[model samples]
Target: MKKTALLATAAALILSSMPLSASAAETAAYKLSIDNRTISFPDAQPYKLGSDVMLPLRQTAQALGLKVEYLPASKEAALYGPAGTAIVKSGSNQARLADGSPIEFGADAAVKSNRMFVPLSFFERALGLRTAVQEDTATAAIFTPEQTEAVVRAIVERLVAGEYQQLSDLYFDDTMKQSVPVEALKAGWEQTTATSGELTGTQVNQATSETPDQQQFVVQLSFAKAKAILSLNLNADNQVSGLWLKPIAEQAETPASLIEEEVIVGEGTKYPLPGTLTLPKGASGPLPAVVLVHGSGPNDRDETVGLAKPFRDLAWGLAEQGIAVLRYDKRTYVHGQSLTPDMLASFTVKDETIDDAVAAAKLLKADSRIDASKVYVVGHSLGGMLAPRIDADGGDFAGLAILAGSPRTLWEIIADQNAALIAAMDDGDPAKAANEALVAAEFEKALALAGLTDEEAKAQTVFGIPAYYFKEMDSRGADQIAAKLTKPVLVLQGEADVQVYADKDYVQWQEALKNNDKASFKLYPGLNHFFAKSADGKVEAQVVQDIADWINRP
Candidate 1:
């Protein structure tokens, strides 16, 4: 029940009886704008002709600060603008500058109702203007040369000056207005400042136009705590269409005590996963090793989520403490899309997670640098829940480390998340009641999972996933499996974690393995899901030290 890929099949069934010109309305629905102002066409409006949005040349050119002149005898039109003069002949795909340089339109320019119409590209190629056609909204925006540089600079200045409301109100397009409202923009900037400290100054590195329609600016920001980069994108209408701000990651020198090697796990098998082996540089003897497993979703060997690389941290930190760590990319992460529907219908955790982990363990055992008998498995989140099963199915680890993992069923965890969301919703909110009903329906499907046979479970979906996936895991619950195992176990949890509750999941693991003297538990205060002090996502150094100490304990 972890995050699985949603396969979508789209079929276009065309009937002979259907009208060929059914899209005519959509073709003529385009609204043309110049310099952020919509142009009204008294004689000829914009229309699509063979994949190009054709606009009346006379009006469109004049709107873009160009003078239009027609030659009746030769059936040619001349557009004179600041850039140069362009000559276009009716029913021709080629245009020429006054200097006689020919430019291809990619489509023919034609005369309709006594008005010469040209493709949208003509404005960009011939007149040297920027243009964009938004197919979703059926609108095209054209920008004159004078509008690009000054507008981009002004936007950056206004943003750093904290003019979110004015930017949202005046410059934002319809899509940007909805996605990043004034409050959202303000909150994002505030969060950036909160992390990077006070905004000291700003420098605009460069403004570039990769495509004819969009202009991108890379700005360097100086903050009290850290320097960051802000990337701003603008549409042809000079609207703020996209924005991103991220702190520059600090570069740390690699420790000389540790060494790394590129290796492949499950080599010559069905899904060979590439991985990294971090080892103590000057080890005199075989060292104890740990195989790092990932949580839900397709994750790389680094287990990078946003900016955090917990697996890499563990590998490096533990190696610095004289412990070797092997981490590999998940199979689903590498081959999720290639897996067909038949493969997914019968897919379980063993195929998604356990098999790769066991392969990694076997790989460690075979390595000459590794101490085979002292090899351990460290699982995080979903990996944590399946640690016992991974050990049972040929991992044969000396110990197990479960980090931020729960003993509950995956569906039960999902149900808990949904219930918590419902509890937090306002009673009178319109979406609250509807979401409640939806959650209730999914809960019923989850409860009905155990009663159905494998064939029936595979046939029906619960919460948009095959019920058989959950049914398979239900029979081999991690708590039950770990309870029966006498292997040394270390359970670590973050007190501030909202995803898996300490009171419920952490307590349950302790209760399940209470009789085993080898079982140990530790809860971190003020740490979130990744066991970091703040949301910045780097795991606390003490946590790694604790793990290394536990592995090397006498």
Candidate 2:
């Protein structure tokens, strides 16, 4: 299976049975380009089947339109455009685009999903994307419109809210009238602690005056238990003018020091996975190990996107409490190689995510300091759905803790995903027609294959299954295997997580585990998918910050 790790095998065998000569195998290769520079793929002889040629996906898809990103570890990606965002990936390619329906690029490529797969030339021509033949290099210019008063306010709010590290990437060089580096904000981050505003407000009025070319808005901020205000300056375009320095009223939670020792876990391994294993300061014997699996989006070890570092905070806090914690660098962030969108369609559950989880679980089990029998898995969001199957894999694990998991097929989940995301947006209009049409088409595809139904026209699903419902179905026998789940399960639900709401999904879980008694479910009254407390499930709830509400350290 290791050498067979090539991606195309699952559906590829169904594609071309023709045995091409070795020379033709060499000719039908792919190359990746970034701003006319080569990133991953190159002019090599004999391209292996099913390899992903990851240049920036955006540069390959038509510009500023809906784009897709892949996170191999999580086994997912994000698709966003004027419509909304859909999570795309190798197995579950459900994210749909605007007028950009899934279509084939030619015999050389096809879109078995919303993800577009193209020959090397498509990348070169589509987005001015190109790779250098002379050297292994990547080059791309990020374009941004000038920041407005609205944009700057939003940026400072995020900075004040601990959602972003820097605003530089958000805007273009031409639009950056002025700005401040992170160093200048150290003092600001130190102040504002213990202030009532530190818990409820972002009004950091530290700097009242503006430099000759700037205006400042200091926002109160908190992270890692430290609280402070962010001083943002305004430029002529109403963009960020510059960064300001302000003395601190108090510094509540400063890192012990920035000089942290970088420990490389897999010392001699190439492409060694990145992660941190935190063991309690004092443990008498081998302790229970918990692997913190991330949610849907491309995330870092911290799971820091938007205001969701709950995973990182949990890892550190729990490890301190005697439970060992393990979290890894998501494939998307690992940065060097990315699975191209083209290769994603043929994906299945085992091909993308399960293997990585399996590898990590085994890696931790082998450690002398860990109790293999007590190895546990705690998955949040999409990882939650994946946990049961992981348990079904016959691994050495204590149990599963699902933070907002689902029991329905990912295909049905996509329909719900579309409804939820669109409802949360300002547009407020349901793209129901588009969603329905896609469902119908998928069911027809299935009916044609199974020959089990003649009512294809009115069929959105068959036998309780929706079209494309199993678009990424691997483990077709999971429900059959559930009869064997003797371990305990903790289902943590957030009443406000409409995207994967407990009422719909948790009920499905309840039914599937029907007569089983080893299960427990807890619904956090006001939490959302991010596990952040909220009144109703809405995108805005994620933006409102609360320190360590959904997670508690060991």
Candidate 3:
């Protein structure tokens, strides 16, 4: 059949493909950009098929925000985009998108390096996504979801295996190769492996500046003894220009005066959250209790990020001072993502934050070891903003403690954080432009949400969350809610926290609650958002002591 002959021809060309030489391929890298931001690919390099650029299939779909499912039985792959679906068969140049849109490609889909390869033109024609390839710098400012995973996997495997020479040859640029000698890299890997144990798994914590020309991937590699972050910053030439490891800070020695317990929060709920309860070791009577709440994101009870665990530090440090403390994993942290589309559509802060916190407080109040009359809530960042809402929902807390709390709208806070992060980046840094583009996109999404009806918002997603969630949050003003609460309030602000500006957020809190005599505020001069000691790079002991004193005060 003529079809069989076409397939054979495509196969013959691919089988004869040769590896690109370093000298010839030095500037042969390709860049992919979607919505004007660069997307970086680490493992699968782009190659040309005549005049068209080709990419690994799965990665390309992911970059385009499409979900892919391969049917081994049929030798077919289905890509589901937000708007439609596309189907491609192996060894065929024919494909179809949703609505029966036909695609005739010059090259047939084939398997290579254990991945499916397809032309970028398929996405451009079928999904209406924009893509470009820059052969000059071997850059593509385009991103697909799969490329990120592949890159992270490749880097983590190489680092853990202690393949320093290969890494230098494959990933490092001229400056990086000169700076990180192979012996030094090998010794570093040996020390890290010996300390952390054999590599078990890796998770991509974050990806930023995903333009086709450059990218930064932060990965959390779990080892037997501990976890460490391997951050890779790649340049236009697809070389590792910057590389570093960030390990979790060791917890300060637990004082003899304190004890920590693992417990469950909201036990009867659909998802019973796990938590840590810290109390004085030898308490003979009921002790005052404070329940710690995390800021935004899927945070553990410790609110672990990078090398910091602010909540854990707070829990043990306060318990050492004779105060009982409780901190639980966020709902979204455990059950938020597993929910069905319908469930997520209706998700809001009420379920994500307020409910579990109220449950924790009720549990604490009922505990024989806790003084029900003195139960308080300590909310940091997003938690702090919702403290009043928690109380209004019958937390019946004795008081509220606000740390790095923002009185501004949640979206405003997010925008400010994005702006600050972008400002901190250096000029001409490719990441800066990409991040700025992301910020612009987020703002556009937020603006679109402002006009949607509540019902419509429920059916949509913004910044990767259900738009209804934002609608519900924007409907309630934490500052207004806090102003009406009669409970004693303690507000703590870090003057140096650019994430939540002290001059803006702290000042707004003081002004809003000035009429409420039960409210008080404390401002630390040099502390950052996490209350870490800027000089020593750990959560300051004094900050913990201050919270304990504020709670213990008559």
Candidate 4:
């Protein structure tokens, strides 16, 4: 299919998903308001259907400075605003946009006692507004663009301030109230704060739900004890229908055989990346060395994810097996926010992964304790996929070991990742189709980077990345490059890894390197993308031990 058609189809799939229903109540007890001013609905109050909040058409639109028109003969109601006009009729599930295109509503427009009631989602799309329902004072706050972030910030403040009673009373829905009582939630909050330490700061990213009227804000809170990502979803009534907090994995106890020393990659350069070097205590000179490389995202030497530190595990385990390991913090991890727009335009895999990786390898080679000819590269995920490229660029490595790598392009993996996540969710999950479209759109944007200049690339972004980044990464072929290399290759995969499936990514590696005598493959029975035993399990000892054995062999 053509790109445009593909995107359009994906978009339609996103819009067609209706929000899951909380209750089947036709009317709610909440009052309506806009911009802090209440609108008293005489004889009819705001109602809810599934995930949608329906309001009295004429008064709701007019209070927001929108011109409303109703043609009784045609049984149609229209809202006219600065951006566009929306036309909807009672009992209709489709709305006509300003461009006269039809968009499906999460719920049908309804009429009772000669008054039309329209879904808030309709106005959210056509008129670019936000709606929030608060049950405490029993008011629904219909707002404009500026209030979205502010609403989320206010809730976070309440959470941090320990105002549990007010917060629960103000925002929590029936499900939240029932599942987690006020006292229990407060205890959990206290425990989190006590365990994770005081909140240093928070970074927030917003996403609109498939219903459009609802919004979700992902807030990353930095604490002294741990870092956590909190996901908060607000319905049209501004009630927090869902909340999730995932804290970083706690670091495991230090190993006895390992001795750690701090080192810097590209030392004395503008990009001096700091890291840790792990070596077996009392080991003799000229030991085999492995430069540890991280996957995508800003990662520390440990390659910390949730509570698991796979890199640290590998480093410690390998050191126990008499190998030296060098692991460093990524460039983007330390100085990402400091980079300017122009700098990001020029940022590529070389700056992100390759150059530093090569530097680390050279650092390993220069060490008298590490055998110069026995230096190898161990890359995980994105790092794994690019290990061959790193080897080709910086020769003299003993071999390359890839863990949970994919032979496909980064964009393809991104699309697959989203699809897999959506598949894991319930079939009726409203966010599934919307997230899929978002991923598809991101890939489509990546496809356009080839013909763009530096300036153009700087102005355009895909998945929050500059087009130049994709342009550079897309040029290298991981499988093809690995196939051409003369060095021995070790491929490792986990059968239970949903992120990079064994059947697809591992199979690709096996097929691509089947003819090469030096290529070897190992598949773990129950490991995950991070080489963990289960969804939340720690890095398996066997996996790390096997890698140690592989590095030690001849």
Predicted candidate 3 versus true structure: per-residue lDDT over 1-554, tens digit per residue: 01100000111111113221211122234666654466666766666665566676766555555567776567677776445566786666777766676767656666656566677656544543434556666544443434545665777778777776687778787667644545446655664555566778788864535333345678887888778777787664456866766566566666778888888999977989999898888888999999998998778788876557888888888888888999998887677435655787888889889999999999899999999999999999999999888888978889999999877788777777667656766687665676577667767878777688989998766544677888888778898887787779999988888779888999999987888888988898888888875422567888888888888998
Tell me the lDDT of model 2 at 24.
19
Deviation (Å) of 268 in candidate 1: 1.1
**Candidate 4 local lDDT, residue 193:** 58
Better TM-score candidate (2, 4): 4
Query: 418-438 in candidate 1: lDDT tens per residue?
Result: 677567766885655765677
- TM-score of every candidate relative to the true structure: 0.59, 0.48, 0.60, 0.59
List the candidate 3 regions with Cα displacement exceeding 4 Å.
1-151, 154-226, 229-253, 425-441, 444-451
TM-score for predicted model 1 compared with the true structure? 0.59
Native-referenced Cα lDDT, model 1: 0.77
For candidate 2, give the lDDT of residue 367: 83
Local lDDT at 285 for model 3: 91
Indicate the residue-level lDDT of 274 in model 1: 92
Q: Pick the candidate with the highest lDDT.
A: 1
lDDT for 434 in candidate 4 is 58
Superposition error at 76 for model 4 (Å): 58
Clash totals, every prediction: 0, 19, 29, 6
Q: Higher-TM-score candidate among 2 and 3? A: 3
Error of 1 at 136 (Å): 20
